[model samples]
Target chain A: MMGAPLLEVRNLESFYGPIMAIRGVSLSVEEGQIVTVLGANGAGKSTLLKTISGIMDPEKGSVSFDGAEIQGEEPHRIVSRGIVHVPEGREVFPLLSVDENLSLGAYTRKDRSAIERDREMVFEYFPILAERRHQEAGTLSGGQQQMLAIGRGLMLRPRIMLLDEPSLGLSPLLVQEIFAILGRLNREEGVTMMLVEQNARIALELAHVGYVMEIGRIVMNGDADRLMQSEDIKAFYLGQQEAGQRSEKRWKRKKTWR
Target chain B: MDGVQLLVSGLANGCVYGLIALGFVLIYKATEAVNFAQGDFMMLGAFVTLGLTNAEYLHLPFWIAAPLAILIMAFFGYLLDLLILRHLFGQSQTAVVILTIALGFVIRFVAGVIWGHEPQTLESPLAFGDVSLGGVVLGMADVAVIVVTVLLTWSLYQFFQRTKLGLAMQAASQNQMAAYFMGIPVKRVQGLIWGLSGATAAVAGILFASKGAIDPNAGLLGIKAFAAAVIGGFGSLPGALAGGLIVGVIEPFAARYLAAGYSQIAPYALLLAVLVFRPHGLFSQVRTKKV
Candidate 1:
């Protein structure tokens, strides 16, 4: 359902030492769509995000974004090329002030006026950041840091944003708010997203396309709605399909091991 | 000499200590590791000055030789960062200390081998005469030391606060990974910091050597610089200066007012007191770990 792929990974294999984290996995995201990678613990979701963003090199295949090869570029170079990655566990620089953290996101950009405009856009998306601009980031709560991380990523104004575990350690309310924000960014800003989440149900719900990665391999893939309704997805994650239920038993199962 | 005269001398010495302390802090902030080689870097600056000012090589005017020496030291600073310091990165802090300790021995041996172990002094514009105010004579070198240290520190403070590169350095010091993500050449900024530290150490070395005969073994003062850093708060530039001044002011006063043996213990006592009370340092932000 597309005009060639906006981002494509064909026969990609990423490794960590001798242990293979992503084995011959291929996926694609179109120009303006949300694609979520849903999986359980020990899955290759984080590696997939990192490898695409050029933080970790894939041992065996190509990562082509917008039909351009970006397999061997450095992470900063990848970011400068407009592929921003918000790493796992919200790796916001804790010692820096909120404003410093935001300013650093536009580190590679030299257009002062445009950078200032983007800064305002990010502040609008997360007003708490403006209020706590001078405050050191480490002191903020988990939810606020997650918001800051996203805000920092938004500072790049990237066409395709790769977010890794944006909801980890967040409260239920905060998680919902985060998902809502992601949905809005996709719908309103037309920013394509590659979201990796352990929360399989919500990830699939917000996504147009979903892939299930199990033990370093792409085990299942299809339309998000269909995957959400699949027996295997329900069996492992949803437990029982309640039409209005978002708080499923699978979260309790994932929390212990995540 | 009266109390005021003794106080003036102590203040000058304190300023030297503070400058060296700043050098220590500069390297530590960039690397998050101690460079025991810092004192040797300072000694090398003085030796370079001697070479330039010697009636042989660049035997140019004082104005030219002093700056040429500092620049040469800065170049070597960059070289050292490229060759030695860069290789030790990502290693444990303890390993960094050991590496630099080894570097210090090499620097001292090489400097002694190449330049000889003879004690020397760089030429100075100031004479032995002192400025007498209300019958207390303050040596010209003492006044020069204090005035120069204050002016240099103030200018450096302005530079760090105003310049974009300086801001980048501060960002890298706080969190290198975040800075790299921002498109900053974090490693290059680190090399620049090391170069700046080398330049600062040269200034401190030149000023300190003015008060005495310079020898290659003089780098042993790095221990004192380390104490100053610990006392001031490891990463705080202001703290390094204040710590240096505290140590400088303590030594002579203790020798004169208290027991001479107690002078050696004074700075350590202050450092211990500060460590036990505010470990993050007087000016440093308390780092919070995610764990």
Candidate 2:
């Protein structure tokens, strides 16, 4: 929080047709820190990540990564600048082989030996991908597809990775496994991450700092541990309250934040 | 003997169709837009080569004229993306289709203005005596056609499977959004794809004109290539080649054994039957949209 953040967004506004999807949203992620944006469905969480990654252009404000502004630049150019967006729904190229998908992740780089080494590294991280390297990506299960998507992102050797809904369709066990990998990636490799998720509990558990967005605006922001302990957060996000004692009438008496 | 002769001729014709069909499939795969102007591009190719080789025009030798025409066509295709198609990105697919159809007409009219109304024969190095085997005869031009088709197809196979740039093209074609996220310059790659397709169409045009006379109306041959693409599966490369060969072979066979009228309708009939049985084409990946 003291030094200049690795990624900084200020007064960002994005629209889809006439409707504003994310408005006046501002946040920052320091290098090597894991930051999570938690929100419910239709809260513009995906929009925030998409705007920052240059998948969608912002109408107002700025996004600066490593001290360089990158608003309205092309997605490919943004990636070359060291930011990679793993889009929502894990959009792996269905017709391509797993190996081909991995190779494509390093598309922007020219270092031949490094690319080969990274390909091997990705396979090592996801051994099942190695086994199915020759198989079409579409044939993989939902969990496996998610792994492939993250694996593809890793091949970029990106400085800042923007991940959207990594746990969206994953089973509980698979989600734990993926979150563990994300934690390891942050801890060991020092890769900065901006994770947008609806799974608040696990997301807060993984992140050092957290932001809560509601209807295209950041409603609350604090340290992850402090947010987890907040009474309003407990009543709304976690559904756990001090006095409730797990009663069936908990929904009836819960304070509405909206 | 008559059957063998007809088969050989049919295959030669099919190879020409396959070349044109490759252009159609390449554009369709990369952009998901069926370029109606693809056949018109072929017509332009023939006209350019004619302008270069005809005694009254540039009067260059066939060797120089053919390569020069191919290069011109490639540049023309690249310009098309930069000047026209790039502006239409993110628009409705139907709008793009209609624009391409209109483009086909524009190319045809321009070709007519430049070349004229009369059909012109193209001269190639192989346009000479026929090679007879027992009772069957094979034109040297036809042999050249087969050799060029095999070589072109083989090289394209190597490109898509072996080369990095080719792999980038495949990735762009499969999922443009994901490709962009993966740091591929999708727009530039798309322009390159259009150029590649144009160059391919040029080769097809030259091979086709070598066998007969070509006129501005010859651009209508694109409809046959379109039919070939549909039969092969619109996005599959090998399917395009197979589809073209099937259509090409069927026409001559129907004309001889059946009736000339049957030959005219054979390609459409085959298309209808395939649509009823396998709408996705023979080699297409059947995709299910995820919720």
Candidate 3:
């Protein structure tokens, strides 16, 4: 990467009331690149994204965005600086209409014309959102809600988006459709993204770089293709197994990366 | 003719109660803290208008004094949240309830010191007039009160339904965390809500003062308004007004038709009945908070 990366987190540590969630986590995402963090449940993937987005204050570490430190700033302040966090569980305002949710995405922007254009662009990206623009967001299906969450993020015209989990609770085909759109968004709009996901296969396919987290620590970091090819990743995360090996024994075996 | 006369007067009083209930609902919706001082805020609003329009004071005209009082009260509400209530964040909701109760006491004492214990009549252009429709007669003051309440309610509805800031306020009230993520400045929005609530209370106070005599103790009427809020379903705005009307209409009829002094307990009796039969109130908008 040339020049400074778009977002850099160094030695980041956050806590959930004395229980450290992410410790000494160091990572960087270059401009316009999709960086995916893959982990099992309780791997602190969500915590890392929350910390970067200023939803959770870090006890120790620095989060620099475009050469400016933003740690400990309020979430809204961080958002105004162009980092939008699409929180886990698609936390769209349940009572609000889809159009209202989208309007709120651009809440910090003052350029009315640009906002109107962005609104049209979001509708183009997720046509279902346009159709249900007047319907309450709570009525949406899980897949549609996830799409609304992403489309809402796009309304910010954000420099970087920290997506906790886009593919969560979606069907296999729906995940493919969402990931394809994400890939297009990155390529066409140049929106830098740091995505955290439990679904490793599809996340790896679209990501330029991948980091594997376990027990609140990063154990592996490499190019996406290389991580996909790693025998350890294949056996543990990808559900591949050696011939004649029982699943119980595979679970009992210690992870090679650790 | 007698019945129509009673209805008009009852409706005017009900509008006052509804406006006060609105103040309660606005603050409750935003912060989930019931301002026990809401009635006292109304008392203070009336006192402020008196100080502005009284012959011995600034002596401003009623039209000028009322809006100025509302504006001043609105700013006071904003500052109250910014300086005091803002610190109460993360504390238990019970703490806020207790603090606001104490605030009510302090407000009453301060009002007593400023305006004295004597009841005062607010001067108004409509104070001396009456309009007769066939055999039924309506006081101009009562008519004005009903008109102003309707206009205010309609404008408030338009604001919450149409404006971006209004939608943002609704968003913040619904989910503070999600609102902040959207860069809506949730704290500031909360302060604005407080201001709006204060302005609403001032309008209620002015209406109450116009139709009747006001003193520091006049704020005690807020108890009836609180009952009205409960009867309407505490969460819904229109419900608050309807609840107020229910309480207001019940009083005169109970007094005239029932035994002597029964009017004093009618609103509370209705409140108890609603609590037993429909605990969530008439137009309950209560939804379980999304986890």
For every prediction, compared with the true complex, DockQ reads 0.46, 0.70, 0.55
Model 2, A201: alpha-carbon shift in Å? 1.0
Question: How does model 1 fare in lDDT?
Answer: 0.83
Residue by residue across B51-123, what tens digits does model 3's lDDT show? 9998988999888999999999999999999999999998999999999999999999999998899999888
lDDT at residue A225 of model 2 (Cα atoms): 100
What is the DockQ (computed on Cα atoms) for candidate 1?
A: 0.46
Per-residue alpha-carbon lDDT of candidate 1 for residues B1-291, written as tens digits (9 for 90 to 100): 577787889888888778888888888888888888888888988888877776754577777877888888888888889887788777789988898899889989998987789887767554246888878888888888898899999889878766667777888888776666666777888999888988888887778777777888989988887888888889889988888888888888888888877878988888889889988777775666553
Candidate 1 segments exceeding 4 Å error? A239-258, B126-129, B133-136
Q: Per-residue alpha-carbon lDDT of model 1 for A1-258, expressed as tens digits? A: 467888999888988778898889899999899999988777888888878877689998899987789996887788888888887777777876898788778777789899899889888778888999999889888888888889888888887889888888888888999899889888888889999988887888899999988888787889999988876677676666444456455444342222
Enumerate residue pairs that collide in model 3.
Answer: none
Consecutive 10-residue window with the lowest summed lDDT within model 3 chain A: A242-251
Relative to the true structure, how large is the alpha-carbon lDDT of every model? 0.83, 0.89, 0.90
Candidate 2 lDDT, tens digit per residue, B1-291? Answer: 888877778888888788888898899889988888888898899889989998888899989999999999999999999999999998987888899899988988988888888898887676677998786788888888888889989999999999889999999998888998899999999999999998998988888888889999898988888888899998899999999889888988999877767779998999999899999887676666353
TM-score of chain A, model 2? 0.94
Off by over 4 Å in 2: A241-258, B289-291
Residue pair clashes in candidate 2: none
Q: Alpha carbon lDDT of residue B272, candidate 3?
A: 97
**If you assessed candidate 2 against the hidden native complex, which CAPRI class would it receive?**
medium
